[model samples]
Target: MSNASTSPFPLAACAEMLWRDRPIEWRASRLKELGFGVGLWNWPEHDIGKLEATGASFTIMNGYLTGRLTDDEGADELIRTARETAQIGKRLGVQRLNLHGTGLGDRGLPVQPIQVVTGVMWLKARDTLSRIVELAEQEDVTFTLENLNLPVDHPGTPFGRAEDTLALVSSIDHPRLRLNLDLYHAQIGEGNLVELCRKSLPWIGEIQVADVPGRFEPGTGEVNWNGIARALKAMGYSGPIGMEAWASGDSEEALEAFRAAFTI
Candidate 1:
């Protein structure tokens, strides 16, 4: 629902991640009660301004990475919506635009060489990212690419690893395209957390935190929160740490576990 933030402080999300039908204004007020604005994902158009009205800070912007961007027209629409969202985020003073780096079309493509030179199917991926960066720059909203692995990522999935996502940042070479590193996913996708964070450095915009097993709170699952926190400290990462994981029980229990594990 939220980001795996180092602060151990709960960030905002829709219906606190339950996905139940609720008003954005209501959600924003609830998020304020919890102390911060959430990365708004499944929100309506009218709520965009309303969520910002609640004084909750924006963390992530969705609407582009779902089953929607499977075709060319959808891709253009995705970019257009993304550009508009970036403008909204800028007006709302949100710092990051979190996005999924790949789509379904990314799944079936085969990697091959051209003219004795092996190259990735970077054309489609590269083009989308370029447009995202250009539009984000217009709004001054820096981008954050979250590492989504497991079953979804295929050979052609745009970016599944921290380095790959970071490489996109390098290839696009845009200051806006950032790595939204999720520690839990890293353990599954790429385990060298220290090195990944070290390599990404300034380009690493946001971080999500959670343990393995059930992907519950840090303590409930299996990540070394203390060590990870130390690594984050070593990297001099000062951005918001999101508690992005499943809850075992109620909100209180979830937050308590989150604090116990993350408040290093």
Candidate 2:
């Protein structure tokens, strides 16, 4: 746990990004030594028991939803998959699972403005997500909807804007459904980081960080880390902010810079 006197949010190490050459257990042990309160993991194959034994909290496994919710069968499949994921969360003693919204058209072109309009897809997705949120509530887990900025990272992802993602969460009106505000993607897709953080504070379950221009540590890119950290602190956002960036040099050096920048 982080000292409340300093940073409001604790820093979490992304297992999929740092020290990846070693086994998951080794990585978890290292994070424990480094005082990381949580580890952001994506795959299901990891040894959850080993990770837990190391004393570093881990996020629930994440994966892309295969079918579109617009069709009956697809919606059914999406709900069933969410139920299964919730079951996995319960089994692992993890409380939060992150998920991505619909991907946009093919990569390599300017994001068409029409992509933002959810249209019928919103109704279908909302209905499907409602049932999924119910399952998540029953399992005592949260599903965080991450906003992936399309033009930079996703290229053609539909739910790239913070407004659309916030609207989805608001429309769902479920306690178990929340947003995962990834600052890196948000900065690339939209420059107003602090305002978005303030507006989405109520529903934000997790926050991930990396610098823009390149997914590197805070000082390596153009993002104003000092300002962003101050804003998060001011808003009383206490969730763990994950370090999801790639290390530009020595890993320890990168971490030190992050700590110094965030003043955590």
Candidate 3:
């Protein structure tokens, strides 16, 4: 239930991935026992009460939008969904809400990337997020714009690069709106991890870490986590750094390696 003020590098275990052996309701408490102050989750839904009972901080949860923000109709839907979820998040002591800006146009069909007229898509996304930011401002919640790797993990996603997401956030300049710089996706979409993180530090609200290629724990792939940690510390980014990755071996062992790599 603490942030950077309590620790040099605030870290959290991803509840969605780690501790799959146990019931989801019990995962936060397990992370708390591991000396982490925060736990990451997606879509609060019915889990708010269960997570609140654990007495650990739910660092961040997905906004859970059913449609892309690439169109007016989808944007309206996202706004409605986010506003509803934000209400539950506030009651559950969740600190931040993560959002994947847009989605593939038409699921269950051939995955064609949004290649035509990128400007229109960007403008639509901007307008869509503007409304979400208003909701976040009203609810006193923080919204994090997460960048995904298009044509890799996520095909046809609009905001696949860090620059595109940052541009959208900058255009809508608000205190509550910030970046969720996911290192794994960043590496896959674009390289130069430390530089990208350092440049985006000002707008960054939260961070997610995993090695590239396999998307496993740090040291398993080519990502230089030690250098990234130093960069974050040097830039004074003391926000919760989320371990969102697959376990290379035992989940606990993966987390232990995470602790050592991040020096938490």
Name the top TM-score candidate: 3
- The digit string of per-residue lDDT tens for model 2 on 96-172 reads 77766542334423223335544777787678678768777677788877787777667555555777688888788
Instruction: Put down candidate 3 lDDT per residue, 96-187, tens digits, no spaces.
Output: 88777553334312133554536787788888888888888788999888888865677666676888888888778787899988889889
Model 3 clashing residue pairs (backbone): none
**Reference-based lDDT, each prediction:** 0.61, 0.69, 0.76
Candidates 2 and 3 compared by TM-score, better number: 3
Per-residue lDDT value at 51 in model 2 = 67
Candidate 2 achieves a global lDDT of: 0.69
Best by lDDT: 3
Better of 2 and 3 by lDDT: 3
Clashing pairs in 2: 150-155
> Per-residue alpha-carbon lDDT of model 1 for 1-264, expressed as tens digits?
343443543344333453235666675666556555466553344556676677776676553444222235645866876766666667667667677644333332322212121133355566777877877766667877777655433343445567767777777777778788777778777777777778877777677766776666667765677677767776677676666666666654665565555455
Q: List the residue pairs that clash in candidate 1.
A: 3-242, 3-243, 4-208, 4-209, 4-241, 4-242, 5-241, 5-242, 6-241, 12-38
Number of the candidate with higher lDDT, 1 or 2: 2
CA shift at 73, candidate 2, in angstroms?
3.4
Q: What lDDT score is found at residue 35 in candidate 1?
A: 59
**Once model 3 is optimally superposed onto the true structure by TM-score, how far is the C-alpha of residue 221 displaced, in angstroms?**
1.0
| Count of clashes in candidate 1 | 10
How many residue pairs clash (N, CA or C atoms closer than 3 angstroms) in each of the candidate models, in the order given?
A: 10, 1, 0
